[model samples]
Target: MHSAIAPIPIDLIPSWLDVLAVWATVGAALVAAVTGVLIWLQILQTKRSVDATEQTLTLAREEQEQNRELIANARKSRIDAELPKILVWIHTQTRKAHDLGVRSASGAPRPLTELPAGKIWSLPDDGASELFISLTVAVSNDGPRRARVTLATSNNSFLLSENEQVISVGEETLIEVRRKYTIEDWAAMSSEVGTRSIQDVLTLTYVHQGTEGAIERWVVRQSGSPLVPVPGRQNCWQLGPFAARRGPLTSLTAEVEMPHRDYYSSMSDLTVLV
Candidate 1:
């Protein structure tokens, strides 16, 4: 037979032991509350640390962008300091006329000098006068650096002396262009004189240094009125004066003429020949 368990009487239990058990339970609850508070504080600290890191990163990015801009501005300043400024103009003193195999009444080719004053040679078939005017165009460099210049024109009417030349600072070089005009062309231009003008655009490509394939280009537009009948002279006409200016190639059609300042103030020794 199994023996039955005997139960102790409640009054026989110790009073101090019950009190100690209650106090132990209260201590465990207090420890749990403190642990939860510590965990919450740790979470708050971690969030603050993350926010600080993000702010640091953002500031660093802004600083980097500022530095990049500063470097770019410095580089642009350096390039501008070394760039060359070129000026172009017509050398009015070098203008001369030439004959183009047109015979006069004597059945011989007439020279320009023998032609009657104030009269140009006319084409035999159309009675249209032919004006062969040769003039020198000056390309002057007023900047501090030297430049290698190449001149080109799409117009078939112009004949350039040479395509390329190296120009030094404070020096000038000449490019001769032969201009031919027929009487019909001149008459049309004469009608518009003082009201409008004709212009021809020439491309000027240049390079400051000898870097391969590094080139800068500009457009030179030369404008003038056509030949007008010389006053008080029968059958006589005079070639009108022309002016040249440099401008950006992109604005070729809308280019405004820069002021006509004397570019030869420091370049007195350079002689221009027709």
Candidate 2:
């Protein structure tokens, strides 16, 4: 019976070899596909790690910037706290006399450009006219310690005359003088003062040392009455007292002005002298 085994078929041998070749190709392709998939997954994981690290670094930088800003603010606050606070203020700008004036050195007429057109004012022999006034002011120290008042400047535009520009806050009333009708005219103008209010504008600049440093203020004037005691003589009113103040200097216009009238008139004196 062993000798009866049939011999292999020569034609079927090629078919078996072809099947083996096909299985070998399939196994190699599967290995390649698995390797490629694993490599792609590794690349994705590396990208995620890099992205996370970058985001963390960015957040850290932002936090660091915030901390730096906070530190700067704290430092500025400390500096501000360490600074000493001192201040000076204007107390009162009281009127002393109303008759102050100015004129050219020569007794002639000078056309003022500061005033309106066709306004020709005469210069008195004493350089006095109805363009100025006499004033006194009060000032105060607004600081914990003592401060010094040093310099003062005038802000005279139209009626440019001042006697005492430098004034103090503590000791006495600072008195200044200049152009216009005398305070004696107050009696004559009392009636007019009751009905209408008039004024003259003046500015005073003061330099002082304190926590807030040097400051400036306007000294203004308002009066209702002026008398033409002399025929056609003009009188400018003095400013109200406003120099005395309690605390620091306030931000205000303080626009007090004297009413101006026609200085040059052709009318004759009609009122009988009392």
Candidate 3:
């Protein structure tokens, strides 16, 4: 009986409820598709935001490094500006004749004329006679700072200034060096004239006053070419062009311990001069 009741609706049209159910199903599918698209767009937008943030952070880091480098360079420039600049050159040289156990000649000191910059001179030299050479060196400050300067020579025979000299900017001072050599010493120096040139090194140590009253130490080394024997002059020699170089400052103990006889003896000589 139950089965016969159901067979009577075979040819009937669809009801409003059935049609409404079908339309509702189609609408649900459309909403789901729109929601899926919106979700994908949101994910893409989130990814772009993350990438933009990374780029900004990377740029910021690069800028920070650049700023650090700039600051370091500025600091170095300031320090370099405050350093002392010193120049040294041989101003004049004079030769005086001396007899054994006798006073030097009363006449004015004879100036040794320099030949061409690189050429040797021709002068007469008395054999077996004592000689006195007086050298006047000019020291100048070319920088904006003032410094206390001390000088020493590589040769132990040359006497230099005793105390530290305060040199002001653009100011020049003269330092006198006097050396007495016997005939034996002169002969020894002359023997090497052709084989090798005799050279002397001059070292200048300075104390620099920097910004904020900071103290710094520096050194400059000056050397001249080997002494060339003057033709027709016995025991007479002349120096060539001079050159200077800058180096790091060293401690007093280290300087004293160096192999240079002049440097080691300079400390004792300074005391004697004082």
Ranking by lDDT: 1, 3, 2
Candidate 3: count the clashes: 0
Worst 10 contiguous positions by lDDT, candidate 1:
247-256
- 2 against 3, candidate with superior lDDT: 3
**lDDT, model 2, position 203:** 47
lDDT of 2 by residue, 96-162 (tens): 2222234455855243223332223322332244433333334343333333333333333232334
TM-score of 2: 0.33
RMSD of 1: 14.1
TM-score of each: 0.47, 0.33, 0.40
By how many angstroms RMSD does model 2 differ from the true structure? 19.4
Clashes of each: 1, 28, 0
**Cα lDDT tens digits for candidate 1, 1-274:** 9998899988988799888999999999999999999999999999999999999999999999888777755644554566667776654322345445344788864444333345442333434656554445678888878877887764334544467888889998876655566755654555554434445545667743422122356554434433555566554555543222332221111232442211111123422111
- 98-216: candidate 3 lDDT, tens digit per residue: 33332336754444333345333333344444554445666788878786876666553354447578899999988765455554454455454342223343455664332222223
Candidate 1: residue 126 lDDT (0-100)? 30
lDDT (C-alpha) at residue 144 in model 3: 80
lDDT value, candidate 1, whole model? 0.55
Best by TM-score: 1
Local distance difference test, candidate 3: 0.50
